[model samples]
Target: MVWTEILVPVLGGDNDAALLAIAKALAEPFNAAINVVYASPSPISLFSWAGEGGYGPTDVAVAAMQESADRGQARCRDLLASLDYPKTKFEAVTADDWIGLRTVSRLADVVIWERSVSRGHGFLANAFQQILLDERRPAIIADKPTKADGTIAIAWDGGREASRALRRAVPLLRGATKVVILSVPHAMAHPCDGSRAVDYLADQGIKADAVVLHTQGDAGQAILGGVRDLGADILVAGAFGHPRLQRFIFGGTTQLLLDSGSPAALFLSH
Candidate 1:
């Protein structure tokens, strides 16, 4: 139930600082290891010459790619050094190294992904999807680092996905100052009271309040409103509880929450 490994992926962009800050905050309480992965494509893949003919690139091209990758890795190391967090490891890998990246992600308790990265394009976005769907691990999407000991709100529906998310967030709930369970009957595909969730948290020594929201609007909007009203720093819920195909095309509550501009971080499990 303890979090020991927190996997964070960065592209050596301006977002690295914010992403690492939150990762460190989540790691401090548990003395967890922050494995910062820096993934970028090799120069060979960027040009067509390597793939056009059955010939490898010249030594000069290979060296140039290696130098670029080294610089990116060095910059990332500098950023981590400036943060002054001791329990951290920086890894450099090609963007196409799915096997290597998954090995790192599978061993992590949770993966921290920047909000913008999820909505972004190309390799990083593909990696995010693979880690969440293929790997089936809990993920936290954040625009900024949330308070480790702040209030938390849970979106409950008495379903397996929500329950799984709850279970994964136990360590965090135990550390929060306050926990609230928000249930919207009209907005749920299978609505149920929040008593069971409240009781479960109670058994875990977490005091929580169950609030039934009577909203006639979209389910995502209702949940977001509740989180804001409660001033919760983080929202815990199941991701893509519905059919993936359906959610992908027409979208669902999960998409809404993901696309929201809310500052609150999301702890999601599928």
Candidate 2:
């Protein structure tokens, strides 16, 4: 269950060093190859141009976007080379957003994304949204550089998505200095036994602690608070158990954590 290929999107041309630092740390454990990709713009659809008079203005716009992306692509390659991950090989490529990033992710073991403060946060941008929804690959948001010896946390719900996320995170779990299982007990019916999670970790020869907390407010907030309390640097969870629309229309736990972006980093699987 070790990752072998990691895809990193270097779109905005900011925070290259930080993103590469995290990628290098993770790749060191498994000798994973890093692919730094700069996504070129997707052409407007036929229907889109029809509504906006014609392709007269559209072609000009597309050309401008391509030019900007080309500059960013050069920055990405230069940045990656400077980092010098002596352990593994890395490649930098330019491609259209739909076919390039998405296709690379489909074959990658995990896709790495970093949000730079200089760049405005575009949570639901088309390229990001498509990457998140691409069921073939899991994505990791490296909000902060991982510690030299980091602690890992897993948010558990006894559901299939949670289980999937946990399994996908085996590589991280094996290397973490400490592991914590964070759970927020339901105010309604029976809650999962937190000890079972601890026991499961024991089976893998990994020691862990379980922290169960009663809700202080929303269940999501409570769970996040628990993660902070434990000082876990890396958190793993399943992304959006509910449909994208359902979670967006009515707030859900996953959405809450995503929107706030606290606790530094998360390894999420859909």
Candidate 3:
């Protein structure tokens, strides 16, 4: 399947440009249409107090929220007009409620977002993570400003999540002239033979070589090393792992890969 419709959130920040660029890159390759969304804080519910009476401040706050939404929409429109793609379409909405998620899940074939807006507080990331896990649509997240070119690496771990990510990344996989599937051997995990992985891709008309690395090092480091050695432009892997107790913990491979500066498009799934 091809990604023909992309939903990108236009959060007012410095990273908005990077988000737009990613939308363009992924969309242009497939001739897709982009839907830009803006999110604003929802209006607060008002209540009448027993002693203190008036709702004057509440009314003023609601008006301010409305004004902010209007300004944000205008900025989004100007940004879309300045972009160069003719087929690139635009939509501006104030996601003051869960309607934003519903709109994206229902209308977008793929969601493109950044890791965080300014610091670690990433509204788009939180929104799209739920979308990817629940909506059954692919979400391409730009953790940092990444250049899309060079070799491509797929981290294969023989799990349901990894399989799902691999299936979703078929279009990008087909385009990469040089693809490598790196499987690391863990103590309890059954090692995947390179031949079997290669044969599986061959059936789907994709020819890729596999390399099994038995490294006594961190999985993320090994994967990054492979990327540098192979000159890879992107890395594809599953998003999360089994939760330990009440806290959610990502596998070492996933966490390290996320923190790296290798200039790769990570295709992730849970």
Candidate 4:
């Protein structure tokens, strides 16, 4: 699929505008149907608030939560409707008192989420992290509104996740005439082996050049420098692996790419 459906969360945060901009940009390429998801927090009962008697009664709290959810849904609808696209292309959905991550994963093709500190640190990060960690869908975490123009940098690690990301990014890659496949050296690394990734791209009719970067300092800084040198418009990379046991292990390269604030449309897949 070419990602004809896009999911944008309306969390009533400062980054709502950035999410909307991402939605707009995606719609241009995919003619995407936009889904505005609002995850209403579960209401806490008075019985649970034993220490704070000032906490409202159960019924009052329930009512307040419902009202807040209703307002959020309305606001999302209004914001999406105000866009340049047709209103029929956008829909508002509410997932109150439910598992937000599961709901988003089931319905969205590509999720556009925000990494905001002001949002208080619960569902926003958790939901996005879950989408990245569990779901097969590609996700774009908008730290700010991104302009999809620069050279597209593909972080190839020769893993399943990286392969999935490369497959999912075909549409974007096809449009980009200039693409670079980056591989970082490891203990098991070989020089000519990296050229196979370039060959794979050539088979798909995408003429890409592979450059092996030595694992010296920060992988993120090296990628940013490479992108700047190439004047890249976007960065294509796999989401990589997550923490499993107590060893703090991960597919390191993807984590480094995510932390890098290069102006690019991060195409991440698990």
- The most accurate candidate by lDDT is 1
For residue 264, give model 1's deviation from the true position in Å. Answer: 0.4
Q: Best candidate, TM-score-wise?
A: 1
Candidates' lDDT values, in order?
0.86, 0.70, 0.67, 0.65
lDDT of 4 by residue, 1-270 (tens): 466777776766556767888777766666767777666555553245654666555677678777876777677667777776752244434444335546656766777766442122655665666666666668776565555444678877676776778887776676666788877666234333357778877888877878777768765667667777777766776665544442135436555565556666577788
> Candidate 4 lDDT (Cα, whole model)?
0.65
Q: Residue 9 in model 2: shift from native, Å?
A: 1.0
> Where does the lowest 10-residue lDDT sum fall in candidate 4?
87-96
Q: How many steric clashes between backbone atoms does each model show?
A: 0, 0, 2, 6
Clashing pairs in 3: 151-232, 151-233
Report the error of model 3 at residue 32, Å: 1.4
Q: Which has the higher TM-score value, candidate number 2 or candidate number 3?
A: 2
In the range 175-238, model 3's lDDT, one tens digit per residue, is 7777788877762177564566677778878889898777888777877787788877678777
Off by over 4 Å in 1: 48-62
Shift of residue 48 alpha carbon in model 3, Å: 14
Candidate 4 Cα errors over 4 Å, as ranges: 44-56, 87-101, 117-122, 144-149, 187-193, 246-251
Kindly provide the TM-score of model 1 when superposed on the true structure, using C-alpha atoms.
0.92
Instruction: Report the Cα lDDT for residue 202, model 4.
Output: 83
lDDT of 2: 0.70
Worst 10 residues of 2 by lDDT: 115-124
TM-score of each: 0.92, 0.84, 0.83, 0.81
